[model samples]
Target chain A: MDQKRKDSASRSRRRFLTDSTAIIGGAVAAAAAPAGALADDKAPSNGNLPPNVPEWMKAPGADVGSQPYGTPSPFEKNVIRNIPKNQPQYTSSASRTPIQDLDGIITPNGLFYERHHGGIPEIDPAQHRLMIHGLVDKPLVLTVEDVRRFPSQSRIHFLECSGNPSYTAMKGKTASDLVGLVSCGEWTGVPLKILLQEAGIKPGAKWVIAEGADAAAMTRSIPIEKCLDDAMIVYSQNGERLRPAQGYPLRVFLPGFEGNMNIKWVRRLHITDEPVYSREETSKYTDLLPSGKARQFTFYMEAKSIITRPSGTQKIEKGFNEITGIAWSGHGKIAKVDVSVDGGKSWKAATLQEPVLTRALTRFRLPWTWDGSPVVIMSRATDETGYVQPSFEELTKPRGLNSFYHNNAIMRWQIAANGEVTNGNA
Target chain B: MATLKVAFAAAMLSLGMSATASAQTHYGIGRPATAAEIAGWNIDINREGTNLPPGSGNVAHGREVFEAQCSSCHGNKGEGGIGDKLVGGQGTLASAKPIKTVGSYWPYATTLFDYIRRAMPLNAPQSLSNDDVYALSAYLLSLNGIVPDTATLDAKSLAAIKMPNRDGFVADPRPDVKDKRCMKDCKP
Candidate 1:
């Protein structure tokens, strides 16, 4: 009886494979093809040829449990995160993501951009405790286990630093340093409103001050409107427990808010009537303008886009290729993105990839046939609220050169006749 | 199978509807926090002068604390070295290369007291006594010419002193710049 069932299953499997061979034959033949191919349809120029039978394939590789945790290949070692240029101290510095080397929307947890105020503190989850007090009717302290026991949701959202391209600071910076301050991840957590309601948010509560347990004791005042809307008490990122560099045990995750406001190693949430103008909010994150006034509490990262492929310091040949990159917004979903091959003179509609979630990175692509002529390439994104991303000149009009944070201006890259691309925004 | 799917979805829909009502459907997960626990972590300072500890320090003691604790990173005169510049930069917000120092652009004086008490001296955060934080705030205020050398800061006095750029901050005026969905013949 078992043999007959197994035989029927084998016949169905053979039939399914045979029927699909005609359509995706080459993909099915991937077993005979090289394991990986370079993006530009070229093999490794270092003579790692197919007929040569590379050394690794000639012998048995390392045993199964050799390295329990997975890692990037040694050849991909250079694809790691890097410290920003001119960062003075390692303790309070940033490790930016290499955007150009990555594809798709999700950034690997290991390669996600990290900006630490007091270096990574080795936090034991058992010792971690989150307190909710201030204007609440009943203040409550919750352990990590108690926090996890609440109804949780997984949301994919992008976390961006308010410090921005400010593009002045990133003048000569290339791909890794270009947009390294932003990354997207699926955060699993309980909504902050649930916790707030549990504490019986008092009538006077309008702003909640989130405080971290780091050496800097980083703190920021979040408006209650945002807290009830999409703020989360995240304990997990990209499926696994939060990485140590990314707040580990717990952190406050406010979708569409600035990175610094998503207080890491979060310990306390004090609901109050007024915004606590902490150093991170008032003095540092404030946006200074030309009229001697600065924009305070600028929480949302506006609509922005960048062409990662053929970006700064890249070489591409003249041929048919797809121009691809990522576009995102904090106000909501990316309603549309346009790609301009001849600078701002003209633009063509880009195809937004499927599953364009709100407050998440949306990959966009446009087909192009390059005739090897010198031209400017860039992208412009418009959010669901119809806020079109402005050019550098347009952005500089209202916000003077003094405004360093919240710069979401359109980025441009110049492709020379030699097929080399470099920074064209400046 | 189809009936089971419909039943499951109906249950989920009812569950979601109850979540919106919110008040009656408490999970009752976390326990009530103790006064001692709240006091230990309730360190944030609001601009309304509330929550400041009951201690005072004058500019004289402030200088000693500044020189010993802060001046290593922030310069002796608060001009900034390894840390951010805490003094000077007055009237520079509109100029090119605007040096936004505490005297020039910080909107509230209470933030200084709050930041120092919660996180300061880089190496030792929350290590400063409430009185020492008040002293450091007074010293910086005097150095920035915002207060007299004899000025002392208690919880009341520190929150009372208004920063020079008190009215210098504006709410987010975004959609501040605009452009259209021009596909071709766009202006350069």
Candidate 2:
């Protein structure tokens, strides 16, 4: 049944594209017809060409040649996440996706999610220095070049804003959600353990405070175990110098940890014996539980999945469509993603795209047949640990509604009879 | 039939309660944040005087440090400048809109000491000595009308001084009576 629906949908899409191309051809012909008679049309009359072909596209070599540093195309200028500037006190603010425009898990660096407390710091790679002090026997100050000399490893991972839960807090209410807060890319950096080993960590140094250079001087105390295990002091994202907003020069990449712990524009690393209980770790990133005992150091973002397509504002036609979206886990690689069309009462394991990396974004696709009937759709991820993504009710039961961070509830999108999609409660 | 209804209600309540306790009860998932662990990282400072480092400073000493280190962004007199306005905004919170400076807005004085120590000098952080931190705190407080210009602020004096907004902050109360539902026909 799914295959049959996909066949029909493909045919319709092909037909639509063909029709649109033909319309463009007809418009060109019409514009050419009056060229012989009208003086204004005489310019392009020599050839069957349409006027107003954008200047950049007119010449084949107009596009900039190879760039050592890459930037989004001019056509993609409108793809930026609209960040709301409320006050000057804070430096970096949140930018929402033009979800209406994006199609995949890879959010461009320019459009990646930003939740900076202070403005992005301008650090000259040569002048900027990273000091590894405290519990290390040799507290060394390494320049950007000095750090790069160490062995580097590359991995593809997704950095999500901790605020990913804020969108689903209100059930069934569709706002301008997905304003470009998520991005995925290959990050190249030196393993943090290498530096620690080089400095020779002292015994009992279990936690290290990663501090950024922003005005907020944002800081979070991360477990030393995680740092020695898989963390990296990343300097490049997507094979280039990190963008200023995405912690250009240097940032701590904590795989499988919450985004906040992955400090950006990092400048200082103090290896200590205790957690500093910085504001971000103690009072801010913590989740107030229903039990009144706040959940602290809730680091791992659990197995959660969201269907980017057919989400809040996107419109889909009734028929067979490819339901594609991203699933990730801080615990481990996603083992399976189950899709539910009947409000999660029933689920079928969706096909996970190949090359799934540990603690990385895994794209899942399921050929879904959307009947004309009104229906609700959702996806739940089961990680390698056999930990399944809990439903919204399951998550909120113990945590309650007061939580403002680390919300990994099951996201549900309602499809109307007319194919209008709305974010709704699962 | 009455007994059957009671059993059904009990079963429903059990199901509801199970849903609420979904978090995994893993032992040793995280160790208590120990003093040794706290000492490892130099970023945070709590109100309980848990992580205050050794060193002391007087208001006079702090004034000199402020002029040399903090005057560029915070202004020479702490009136406010390129950065946030840190002084003389007291008692404005109740008027029309509160000027949320260190003295007028922040709920705790420890937060001020913590923030300054962790991130200060506008350009160079962690550069100040603990004594400088104490003196800077004293100078800022004096500028904000919290203390006399000559009042020295050391570890002893700093912690005892109460912030005007100390009682302004509230703890989150949730999943309680406000969230409870009362219905005659409802089960537990």
Name the top lDDT candidate. 1
lDDT of each residue in B114-136, candidate 2, tens digit only: 87876676457667888899888
Off by over 4 Å in 2: A1-75, A85-92, A97-105, A171-180, B1-112, B116-153, B157-188
| Candidate 1 lDDT by residue in tens digits, A315-346 | 88899878999999999899999999988899
Encode model 1's per-residue lDDT on B83-104: one tens digit a residue: 8888988888899878888898
Candidate of highest TM-score: 1
Q: What is the TM-score of chain A in candidate 2?
A: 0.82
Model 2 whole-model lDDT (C-alpha atoms): 0.69
Candidate number with greatest DockQ: 1
Is model 2 an incorrect, acceptable, medium or high docking prediction? Answer: incorrect
